[model samples]
Target: MPTEDHQAFVNELVQEHGQRLRSFLARRLHGAGADLPDLVQEVYLRLLRIPDVQTIRSPRAYLFTVAIHVLHQHRLNLASSPEAVDIAEALPMLQARSGDNPAEQVEAWDRLEGFYEVLGELPPKTYAVFVLHRQYGYSREEIASQLGLSYAMVKKHLAQALVHCRRRLDAME
Candidate 1:
């Protein structure tokens, strides 16, 4: 059950916006284009699923929308698996943007304080797990070995850490 023009339309999308979509994903994905091709294929698969491709007013936005969802799934996978998530990658995201002014500095400090306050509320081992990975740049395997904990335990701790961080950040906002 193949539409005769479906392949043609998919090709058009790639021909027109392929580079732009890849570039957008590259920037969002830590500037690594390793997964760029796979993500693009996924985008095409999604686009082809639409019953009518002609109905799309802005294919560029549609492509971006799918790409972002794909990126989100990638992040969620990272959140669950320490081997994929990098603390350095998370740091910039966590940092509060500050203007070049004393007032902005004060606000940033306040946000930092709130973040630390939330971290402090976590269970001791869970907090330690986060610090080991983020501050020490320890792999989850290394953290597990250092703490004499199981891999599953390390993953659980990371999940707990992420949930707590998101909850507090949302509340603060």
Candidate 2:
């Protein structure tokens, strides 16, 4: 395709299906709407790279197919990042152990209340990252994706949450 033609074709596709494409990606990503814009851009970039858009019989289907591929690649990239595992391992400090006796259970309950108080004091995003990862078993990368934060930011939030909880809980003892 000529340069002008290719641009026009790509622009037309974006104009027609951009909103639906974004909605599709947002749903597939499981509320990771933060990455929607980037993912949509990637899909269009891929579409532009196709040597012959004319060869496609079904443009809407083709567009969604490209979106699915982008989503798959995104998941693969997130899965291959190894740093999330290391940070996740360091989070064992946040896990509460089971109490074997009534006195210990009472102490555990007290500590749990203190922990909730500390969580409430956190900035909303930090608290979300901490709870989603620790309580809900989401990986750091997943939290980063869902929350639209960088991986380092997610790690920092988790660390801050941990430190704050520890200090506050210790004081409660």
Candidate 3:
């Protein structure tokens, strides 16, 4: 049972904030072959199920927050699947592009994967805060609130994580 007012509100939200939402997802999912329109549709679908959509004070920011969550869930699902193929399979055919070197690109990806593996060796809370802030683009304040951590603690953890990542990357280099 959908109310006309609610439908109208959603429509208004789509019209005003749709592009920004899509662009946000576009940047986060740059190499994942994620369709912006499809992601936007999924966001709207989730919005429809939420009973308190109208109560949100900043719908645009809320929409981006929801979209980020959706993207995170999508990545988790992909990572969880044993049969999932590597994203390199979806890269554009660039044989004709003079500046493109598939070998180098693949090497870089492997290095990044190794970097993430090193990141995983960190304590769970430290890794979680680092991933939420660095990978998922959550602010320190937002991550602290979500994880029930003090802001100073989050900063300290991030600083430590960054130093560790730097050392690891340097060694790799």
Candidate 4:
């Protein structure tokens, strides 16, 4: 059960920030075909469900923090489920049809595969930071707090990982 004050606080926060939140989600989820407004509403609902969350000083930051976690979980859930192979089959055709030479296309795919492989080889913590910051558009501060790491440490890990990825891809060419 939520307290009346907490409920009221949430209501006010939603009213103030709802549009901004929707826009944030829309940019992040561009072309995903998901309903950005619904996702923003879900984040608010989750915030309401969290015990004593109203005690936080900056509720807007807390909302974004929760929203990031919710988005990550949603993506993981979707990845775990088996899906149709239509997209997979069409990917090569799409790539080939794009205005590029055959060799350039192959090299591009190879570099991408190498990048994924290098990412997999990274330590879990480093890889999480890299993915959150690079793939998911999280800021260094947000990644540091979410992973319980220092900002400097996150920066170091990300820089080293990027260097390694670039080196690996260059070596392949």
Taking all chains together, each candidate's TM-score versus the true structure is: 0.46, 0.47, 0.49, 0.48
| Comparing 3 and 4 on lDDT, the stronger one | 3
lDDT of 3 by residue, 1-173 (tens): 55765577678888998777777667656476556667778888887777765687656545655675576556544533555421111111112222346566556445644554566456556666777777667899987887677999989988988899889889888
lDDT of 1 by residue, 68-116 (tens): 6565455444544554333221221245556456677567655754665
lDDT, candidate 4, 37-155, per-residue tens? 66777787887787776467557656655665555455444433455111000000112232336566555544543455555456556656677777667889987887677899989
State the TM-score for model 2. 0.47
**Reference-based lDDT, residue 121, model 4:** 57
Ranking by lDDT: 2, 1, 3, 4
Give the alpha-carbon lDDT of every model: 0.68, 0.68, 0.64, 0.61
Error of 2 at 18 (Å): 0.7
Which model scores highest in TM-score? 3
For residue 9, give model 1's deviation from the true position in Å: 1.7
Model 4, TM vs. native:
0.48
lDDT tens readout by residue for model 2, 1-173: 34776778779988998888888777666556788889999998888888887787657657866776676566545434653322121111233454456566556544644554555566556666776788569988898987778999999999998898888878877
Candidate 1, residue 169: how far the Cα is off, in Å: 15
* Pairs that clash in candidate 4: none
